[model samples]
Target chain A: MDQSRRFTQVPGKYFLIMKIKLELFGASRDLSNKDFLELNLKNKSSIKDLREKIINYVDQKFKGNENLRKIIETSAFCSEDNNIISENYQIDKDQKIGIIPPIGGG
Target chain B: MLHTKIVDLSKEKIKPENAEEFIASSKFGASIVFYGTVRENNENKKVTGITYDSHDDLVIKSFKEIYNEADQKLNIKEKSVYIEHVKGYVGLGEISIIIAVACPHRSEAYDLSRYIIEEIKKRSPIWKKEHYENKESEWLKGNPIQAN
Candidate 1:
């Protein structure tokens, strides 16, 4: 299999136009504490598509961590307005999105 | 009247000189203050220092709720209350929490202060990290009973 074709199978690279800022917390600090990457999504990218992009990207970066992938899958994305947008939500251009882990503090 | 304020006593500088003035602002005849300090011993273990952390928004909201409940339950009118909890690190003998209540009488002030502290400990979302002499850290979920 070609590397480019395999890359598409990963989940983190699906977005083409909207920029996102991913923050790390707790055990996620091991992967990339300051791993904020910007991706420009193609116009009218749905939330489901963007989540696929994220999964692909993270899969490529981490390679063998199934646990991290599960965490990413279960995690929710918060828009700039603090709204929890599901993986299938539509993405708007230049929107600031945050991927947050489960908050466990009392 | 009921008044309450919760502050980050660790990072934010608290002026001790103004403490008396602030706690005695109302024309109350008596004011009681309770200071909770970090000690060197916990559960028979030598402690170095303690680190406290909390969700800023949630802690503040919880403190407000507790304060309101105290006011309503005690029917404390013409009284003022102050509460502060340390965030970050607190050394031995450093005050981690402070509660002051002023009322027209000493008994009421004492009772109110105790009630507020107990409720804050039971209800607040603040967590404490205890650093022991062996360089070990343990997270305490709720306030543990202390020996006077």
Candidate 2:
């Protein structure tokens, strides 16, 4: 699913935090060594926001790994329909999203 | 028959005969079949195998899109195409992908086959990690995905 329905109360603000599921593929999967990653962000975030979070995550967890960071930066997010979503597209609900890196197939 | 498939090697192997049989017809004069297999060496590395990973649903969607794009670009309405790519580990000399096409002319068949494969390489969400003799592996670089 894209985001978990369970929301958390922000300490200062009243907005809920959404838990999102990002499916990894190709180099992204290889670098992360995971099939998918769960991210928590503010409700109604956009694909661009997700990208930043992923970059930050890679930076913190895989420090000095420029290759992984570059892959995440160059990647695009895909919706459940398998179409690449625009960076401005909002992610307000639960759904499984895919992180598409560069592709090489015969 | 015009189709695309993301084959799971553990469940079934890709067969050339199946593609040939599916594309066989009296109306078509030429058929082109391309099979990609694991090689023994690449970039000076003694390659042992390849692990192909893919987003199944997206790969199938990309295949359909590539086929449709091919049809529009080539203006070939009447054709038969069968495309399959493996989705798991493949050893040396094992088949990784197959693209079979049948058309009214040899040149069209060749062009169509070439176009489809090229587009799939750029559009499909599939990746390959090469396993080498030294037990090391690396994912090959590819074209970046563009937001649709």
Candidate 3:
């Protein structure tokens, strides 16, 4: 059988690709009009790696301001389903990430 | 119901003209009021004036949450609570937040009033910018503390 046909024929043996969608808000929103970011990975990427990728993207976008970086480091990131994942949590490929800035001002 | 408003809390007008109405409407024997004012000094800087800013929606939401938490913990009726905060620039000696709580007794009112202020300071996202005498301004983070 062909590779694609054999994969399709196998009920649960085929590898499933995982994709993550990221959304940014607040000062992070100001970083880019590309409001939605997507990352495709195998099912094994840890949430910590996802966070590192996000931090790198943010760092590249906003080169200035150590304060902003520190603030982002401390800010919380949530799944689109509103699950609070620890930085080290493993992320499924099809999961969604929401980046939330630390809210300031009354 | 608790009443909350965002305004430029002013000391000159701190005594609301309708104070009599608010006092009269309360059946509680004790009504405690707390006025938080802007001081002339912050940290070691001479503050000429202070500008208060907030994400109004979030701030109000947080304030309401704090108010609700107080009500739940204290079991106080909705009618016995009132909280107001200043959102814009408030100069020296201006009132920033006014909290009034009425309870059947003096102790509850006093305790609740203090608790509300403390919680608001710790949780509210409101920030203050201190304008120094030397024409410098600094953003103050977290809660305000009494000058040493």
Using lDDT as the measure, which candidate wins? 2
Q: Which numbered prediction scores highest in TM-score against the true structure?
A: 2
Clashing pairs in 3: A18-A93, A19-A93, A105-B125, A105-B126, A106-B125, A106-B126
Chain B alone vs. reference chain B, TM-score for every model? 0.84, 0.96, 0.82
On a 0 to 100 scale, what is the lDDT of residue B141 in model 2?
Answer: 82
List model 3 lDDT by residue over B35-147, tens digit each: 78888986788888877665445456667887778768876664366777776577788777777777788777777888788777665656666789999875554432111
Better candidate by TM-score, 1 or 2: 2
Interface RMSD of 2: 0.9
Measured on C-alpha atoms, candidate 3 has an lDDT of 0.63
Residue A7 C-alpha lDDT in model 2: 53
True contacts kept of each: 0.03, 0.94, 0.13
Chain A TM-score values for every predicted structure, listed in order: 0.68, 0.85, 0.64
The DockQ of predicted model 2 stands at 0.83
| DockQ (model 1, Cα) | 0.07
Ten-residue stretch with the least lDDT total in model 1 chain B: B139-148
Q: Please list the residue runs of candidate 2 whose C-alpha ends up more than 4 Å from where it truly belongs after superposition.
A: A1-11, A31-34
- Candidate 3 docking class: incorrect
